[model samples]
Target chain A: MERPHNFSAGPCILPLEVFEKASQSVIDLDNSGLSILEISHRSTAFVGIIEKARELALQHLNLQDKGYKALFLQGGASMQFLMTAYNLLEKKAGYLDTGTWASNAIKEANNFGKTEVLASSKSSNYNYIPKDFLVPEGLDYLHYTSNNTIYGTQMKTFPKKENTPLVCDMSSDIFSRQLDYSQFDLIYAGAQKNMGPAGATLIVVKEDILGKVSRAIPSMMDYQLMIKKESMFNTPPVFSIYVSMLNLEWLSRNGGVPSIEKKNKAKADLIYSEIDRNPLFKGFTALEDRSMMNATFSLKDEQLGPKFDKLWKASHINGLNGHRSVGGYRASMYNALTLDSVKVLVDVMKNFEKTA
Target chain B: MERPHNFSAGPCILPLEVFEKASQSVIDLDNSGLSILEISHRSTAFVGIIEKARELALQHLNLQDKGYKALFLQGGASMQFLMTAYNLLEKKAGYLDTGTWASNAIKEANNFGKTEVLASSKSSNYNYIPKDFLVPEGLDYLHYTSNNTIYGTQMKTFPKKENTPLVCDMSSDIFSRQLDYSQFDLIYAGAQKNMGPAGATLIVVKEDILGKVSRAIPSMMDYQLMIKKESMFNTPPVFSIYVSMLNLEWLSRNGGVPSIEKKNKAKADLIYSEIDRNPLFKGFTALEDRSMMNATFSLKDEQLGPKFDKLWKASHINGLNGHRSVGGYRASMYNALTLDSVKVLVDVMKNFEKTA
Candidate 1:
């Protein structure tokens, strides 16, 4: 059977070639005659894998010469919520609570220091990005989420803050588009999204910005220690990191982030155009603030839900259903999502209208 | 090529059946047509995997009606080192410093509370388990490493501590043998040895002993919260957990721990008997404290090492090289290591002696 177009919010679609490579490695990695899952992390074969992975991440993100280090660590983005605070939040930090992930980041930051919310979109249930926000002076750092996974919103442009470090949670949109990757002092993304599997987190940190905190950070949560150890601080998520490396290799081979971004734009435009033209469907997010990765929409006639659902299912659409908080539809088109798949979804929407 | 006799200390051998299943899942799980890596962790299919993993862990350990909960967590046992202290260490804790792992656990515990080294085998370079130790009545808990991976020593008998909770880091040798597992109040193992991959940790805790500390525990590190959420507190190490579940299933099908223990004993005895008989090599650990999981040894004639190394390599004995500190050899015979492999190793030693 052909694999369906999976639009899961995360741990979502990955390149088919990457999956095949990962599957092969799980059986016998580098012909060492041991499952990648069974080999020691410190073995020469695995150490080369991790080194290559870190090198690939730095190279792909264009952070190799930018005084930044790419670390493939464990615990995902949620662990980073606390780790970022434990490392950087000394006196105070400013946060823009654009969505659920940003608010959660703010909550965790409050545990370490005075985290002032400079802007919040909760007033409108995060339907749009919070602009007209202050990037205050005297802050240790200004933090924000680049893309809101749950709310289907994104920051089109970043705010300019003078002399203040910027931190971004790019968990949902790390490699889906082209961006100036060197601007932020810190950036983190869970690998499950565009990177790889669910266990490892890809953290890009500027080397000079650490060790400013007075508190003794736990070894596991300390960024300085991880960077010092070159991300082998402990037994890393080996399988996760290996799979991520395979995905990174795949991305590099198929033209880097810029090429993928073009394909992503074409896919997103197809779905958004269908949502706008289709009489039976309406997008939930404001036009300017809509996410290219996740396009949230709802039916114009709520009673036709069963018909639309049947149509999409018959068309082999998986995870087209939206998040429970905004119950309608979410077509998440990450890097791995094909334009042809988007056409299928658009065709489903148009065919459903004719039937109605 | 067939998988070699992988004698890696941790991230060691697994059943061939587990590896095949894990490889298939990496491609497509349960015929979902989507790679397990590409599916949402929140999907019912994934949730069922975690549930079955927890259930199997409890069932295999005979803890079903024992008021204990099994958790498949991320960050490995290194994270548990600090978390164990955060949740349980209130004022004081007792530690048995058996080896590197035990000492590290004590070091982490000391950050949260006063930790007393109740016993230590470091005087002998941790080549033997300490027999004389007192579990004080006023301690919060007694922590120890069940198997010392580096030093190749294991505790055959545990001290009976009345009114004192027992915490065991069974990281390197959790399911390789049969033991009264319910004796431990908190048992944590990094699931690289005798289980599955490196990303997940197996933690079994007696439910009634949590929430005794005053500190606000970090969400990721809080055992009570993890128990409440059933270890889905965050995006878990899904690939690792699924592989661990498959390994556990294989263990259940292959006569469980008791049957595995019989085979493990046979393997260990085969290698040890050869070490005792062979004049070219000598075992490292004391006879009484010799580990069934890891058999550490060194060449009797150090100058004959090169020839012996060549012999083992020819015999397809992988990871027989001991830790750098030990500077010799380590034949780690975990559950998946067949007695036939041990016979092969023993045959290699005999052949090497004849050549010498």
Candidate 2:
């Protein structure tokens, strides 16, 4: 198979070094004679792995004492959505709908209690993040997706009301850029995106916001149990945890989020410039709310569809197709995506524009 | 540092090749330019992986339309102990306490409904599997552990009863030998010992025994939800599932269990013979009920204990320490243990006997 830039939504691309080192651990971890998979989670070595992963996460996010406890949990961000509601919401909840994931959060939260859709841009086919969205006054909590990957809409700026705690699903944008996490009571992202791997979900929850729920949560859903155990309530995905550590280490060494944010700006700029300059191509999402992580667009000449798709595939480019939930093509420029790859896509788009 | 024979009860030894292959997937799954750790559970490739893993499990266990569904879950056997009760036992339950794990099953079962210790060998320190154990007339199910890795005891025979289900935690010795599995209503195992890794738990439950409970179980804890989703209700541990496939493949090529049973017997016979015949060492477990997996023993000369431990460590043998609850050395010869390793232990015992 030709080397293609993977734009598949998670479990997405990981650094080559993370894979190679993680592979070797399957045979023998740090030459300990036991496969990393064979070691006990209760063992000191794994305990260190979990702790280091947590420490790196804190350092990388620079939220060491922002009233948040970082937790690496099983299940995925979907589970965290339920857990967030299970732990926090008693009567009713508030959700800002920008895309599929935020709506998914709303659906799961509704299973537990009343979930009010505070605002939605669904009437615009989710092309924009509704700026005038109202987060209800008496909501148990307000939730939003930081970056909408499917529809390619992102909220460039957040409205801050210090009285209410914010919960954000930064699944697609985590580690891609720094955030004012202090404004959020809870943040969760599945690791497949910019973090490490798919099997673990990273949750940053403010401890003070807990202990208000009246329901008896089963042990698996209880954030308190996860916190008490320090996310070692059971055997965590060790390999995922370790690879995440490697990615975190990579992020920290490369001047952290500030440096990566610049690289992100450059890549997003190149691809968006291509989309704007081209006559045949048009970005589908509302321009002001365009995503930096995922750039989505389509051809104005619908008949050129087959030729354009075939061109990108022939050039060994992958994950360039948009989500089937909405039509057209999308390019996910995650953290692992390099500037050259974006240039390749830009060049491909330019040629397609000229030919059309 | 030293190559010690691992005696860790769960999160125990696994097939070396499984570890190697599993590790490779962690970094790069099927060379898809995607790490298995980062792959989507919904992707065609990962769906195949989960499906095939479940198929192999069903095929190997000869589950045979017994109305049993096989699922890969988390929280280990301990969670299953509670889940089994939550799903099936609306009334009273019965548990036979042979050792630590079986008692744990009883403990978790009590959290849901009434539980009777139908039989217990705790009085004898659980050295022997009690025979002619009474199966209570009216109970939800009779629970037993097939093998006691901690106490070095094996239940050679199970209670023969119809109309009632037999639930067993075959965690330590699930694939060690053949069994009339038709007799068991539900069987669950943590995969670290005879199966694969720690993060995943395998459960086989008959359909008839479920849907009886009144208490609301968290969706994560409900076995039925796992079965319904084919164990992908949430992000299943992809790396662990892949490793389990390798182990299952290894087991299949190994002429399945018929071949493994013979090898397990031979290894146990060689080591048990040395312990029974040797004068300086006495088998700590009852002779009639010694474990084929965990062989426990102590020296007649207690002062030479430090020397024996150091000697084994110097010889590059490891994981020989027994449980802190039961102090002594235990040689756990799971499926991956070569007969040659047991010979090494037998030879060491012989040399110590002559010197004493």
- lDDT winner: 1
TM match of model 1 to true structure: 0.98
The DockQ value obtained for model 2 is: 0.43
Candidate-wise lDDT, in order: 0.88, 0.80
lDDT of 1 at A64: 90
User: Stretches of candidate 2 above 4 Å error?
Assistant: A121-126, A137-139, A155-165, A301-303, B1-7, B23-34, B64-66, B79-86, B89-92, B97-142, B148-154, B160-166, B208-225, B277-289, B298-303, B354-356
**Top-scoring candidate (TM-score):** 1
Give the clashing pairs for model 2: A11-B38, B4-B317, B4-B318, B5-B318
Candidate 2 residue lDDT tens string, A1-356: 44467777666777777777878877778878877766767778888888988988877777887777889976677777778888988998888888877887887787689988878887878888988866567778888899998898887777756567788898899888867767778889888788877667898888888888888765666777788989876567776787788888888778889899999889988989889889888999878888889898988888999999988887768777778877888888888888988888888888877776
lDDT of 1 by residue, A1-356 (tens): 88897888888899888888888888898787888988888989888988999899888888898899889888888889899998998899999988877887887777778999998879888899888887878898889899988878988888868878889999999987878888888999999888999999999999888998898887888898898888887788889999888888888999999899899889988999999999888998889998989999999888999888898888788988888888899999888989988999999888888989
What TM-scores do the predictions have? 0.98, 0.89
> In model 1, which regions exceed 4 Å deviation?
none
CAPRI class assigned to model 2? acceptable
Tens-digit lDDT track for model 1 on B1-356? Answer: 96687888878888888888888888889898989898888899999999999999888888888999999888878889998999999999999899987888887787788999988988888899888877878788888898999888999888967888889999988877878888999999998898788899999999888988898877777899899988877788888999888989999998999999999888888899999999888999999999999999999889998888888898788898999878799999988888888888999988888889
